[model samples]
Target: MVVLAKAELEQIALPAAQPPMADVRAVDLSAAPGPDRAAAARTLVAACEEQGFFRVTGHGVPQELVRAVEAAAAGFFALPQAEKEGATGEPVGYGCKQIGDGGDLGWIEYLLLCLTSAGTVPAASFPFSTLPCAAVCTERELLEEYAAAVRRVACGLLELMAEGLGIEPADTISRLVADAESDNMLRVNHYPPAPRPEQQAGRLLTGFGEHTDPQIISVLRSNGTTGLEIAGRDGAWASVPPDADSFFINVGDALQVLTNGRFRSVKHRVVVSSERSRVSMIFLGGPPPGARLAPLPQLLGDGGGRSRYREFTWMEYKSCSHRGRLVDDRLRPFEN
Candidate 1:
């Protein structure tokens, strides 16, 4: 790993504006492919290649829906410490699960599920406490609604990604996912106030440490707090701003391994913020189940084969996530 100087990190922490909220919506997927497609694809590629991150607005998820989920999450965190502990899971830095179920909280007190299986919290790989605010129907409804919207947006994005890669979108999608049950997740994470950044920079890190995502890409939605950081190609770190209405997308680790690094899985992390609370939902792109994961055939092109990582089940990779060993790390768990 390349250790960066504090100044370099600070430089990376600089932020750029998200695309206008009205322009790129969550529901824009409904729009037909117009001449805007070229400009949009070019812009998307620029961001991906240079920053590994960018925001999308008009994403179609109503703003009220986003607020409702945030509000419900806040209400849950507002509960008494004991109540919170009752629902909080796995320890911090390792991804929170339910408490006594015993892991500590990651920089978040959160819940993890999927758009496809909304409201039904199954046993996920990186364990933690179950969702504490099960009673919050508003949160569940709004969340699932947003998740569904995102699912549509993700499909559109994948198609766009396929176009960007010069192949038919369905062709790429068919090869990456398992069957019809490809993996997609929704994590509602809460990061409470924390120790000063100056202090943390010297010792322990925040909710998560720096690591690349392990999925193809992730669509993220966050509240107005800035603890997220991304690594620049120049070895700098940049702050990922909260672009209202838009979702942040970045490639994941598994994709990089499968692509033999042709597609980068940039490093990103969540940091401590003393100013206010933080919340965000990140969705990962993956295929159904045991599709022999490998480099997209498109990448192989009419060219030679380039093998980097061996094929494995998304389930197998996800399950071994908590094995406590790093040398043979393969599965791409939610948290870094």
Candidate 2:
């Protein structure tokens, strides 16, 4: 892996302004090309290639469900800090910066849960935990419903991605992510207003540091607060504003590996904005821990059939992220 110095790391962390937020492209999943799914697949290929991020509309998820989940999450976060921190579980439950070395990263709290057929796994089984607030139990039904809805959309997107790559919709990337056994999870993030909103070295203090996601794909719904940004091809950062009616799909490290870099794993971060508190939910679809991932031969483009990355399971890459720095390239260790 390439070792970056502090100055280089700081350079990578800087943010830049993008074109007007209204200019971002949106995809209609319900669009029909000759009464088939191929049209949406082709439309997404170009969009996905563009910085690995795009907005999705016509996703068929009910607005009432979205509101219900958001209300439930907000209620959970509204609890007293101590009450919110009372119940602990592995890799799931509530997390605040209070216990980690990331105190200076800015004000943020999150609830992480692993998805399963039976519903969300109990927080106790996660690798990390703080506590499950009373609201978690109260909101469990809503959370489960929300997860099912989002997971359906994610699976549809993966099918389109597979079709875009000229493979069977059910045989390619979808196969890795579309089952109950997949190690998919959802994270509900709340980024509160930071104490210092001033710029630091040309960047605002971040709620979450800049890094590419580790899953195959991530579907995000942000409340109407603007702070999400992605690193552009020019090495500058561009903010993706909150789109209430759309899901922002981000290609992750696993997809980058699967496509041999034809698509990208965008480096993104959440910066603290104005006094308005913000909420965003992310449903990350990934392969089961034991699944081996590598570039597909179909996507290698016949240049002697070489893959850009080596075969590695999601668990191997996840372990690297947990043990090493999150800002570092988690995929670098997997390159042959």
Candidate 3:
């Protein structure tokens, strides 16, 4: 864990600039199944087509569970650097500073965990087991509960997306995520506060670099400290207001391909704050490694018009994405 000092942050901080607040669409998922649910689905589809991002409320995840998991993650992140490093593992565990093996760096620290189809965290990758028995038990339980709750929310949202697209079975897209072999992951990120406002010149520290998710979808919730920004279609960045109670969704590269270019894969990043830490938990929903990814025939016109992206397996796309920088256009090679 290489923590950056104030001087190091200053050297990398970009000039401060205020971006316009994005008018992100919000949908209420608790609507009863009928006209209300239909309306909500319509809204979701519009949001996906326009920005590939939206905020969701009434997601059914208990606020208490959300808070508990956040607290546990915070406690772990607050641990001494050496103590936290004990839980480190390959691809899944505690990581700081370095974003990926490609040498991308960020002003962030994170815990990455994988969830099985059974909704259980693999004990082999458990980061809390090294702690006291009681602490480990509590943390593990909280993480499992949180993962289950969020998984439900993610699947439900996918079902609604399918509905809005007027697709058959309404699970055409969602089944990929609910599959027994689905590759799902949860990441908890902590961006520490920067130096005092007066100590540094006007600048913003990059917490996470701009990038599009390689999975099918991503659901994120963060402590109410603003820093998130998403790039618009025009290629300008806009800030997203923090809403702790609602989960923000991001359409990923897989989904963009699946929809035959109807949906977009949003690019986003986080900037560090000077007064408060930002803690975010993101659930990345992915298909199995062997799952074939291509444009849905239903989305293509009756004659099955040309597919914008070439067919590829999830593993191939994931491998391609891993070899690039954070801001690289990962889907270029797959484009037709």
lDDT of 3 by residue, 144-261 (tens): 8888888888889989988888888888888888899998999999998876666557778888989999999999999888999999999999999988789999999999999998
Off by over 4 Å in 3: 5-11, 196-200, 302-304
TM-scores, one per candidate = 0.72, 0.85, 0.96
Q: What's the lDDT for residue 93 in model 2?
A: 71
- Best candidate (score: lDDT): 3
Clashes within 3 Å, all models in order = 46, 9, 0
Local error of candidate 3 at 80, Å? 0.5
The digit string of per-residue lDDT tens for model 2 on 99-145 reads 23322333478878888733365544432223355544557667777
Q: Which ten residues in a row have the lowest lDDT in candidate 3?
A: 1-10
Task: Tell me the whole-model lDDT of each prediction, alpha carbons only.
Answer: 0.57, 0.73, 0.88
- Please report how far candidate 3 places residue 180 from its true position, in Å: 1.3
* Cα distance off (Å), candidate 1, residue 230: 0.5
* Local lDDT at 48 for model 2: 75
What's the C-alpha lDDT at position 21 in model 2? Answer: 45
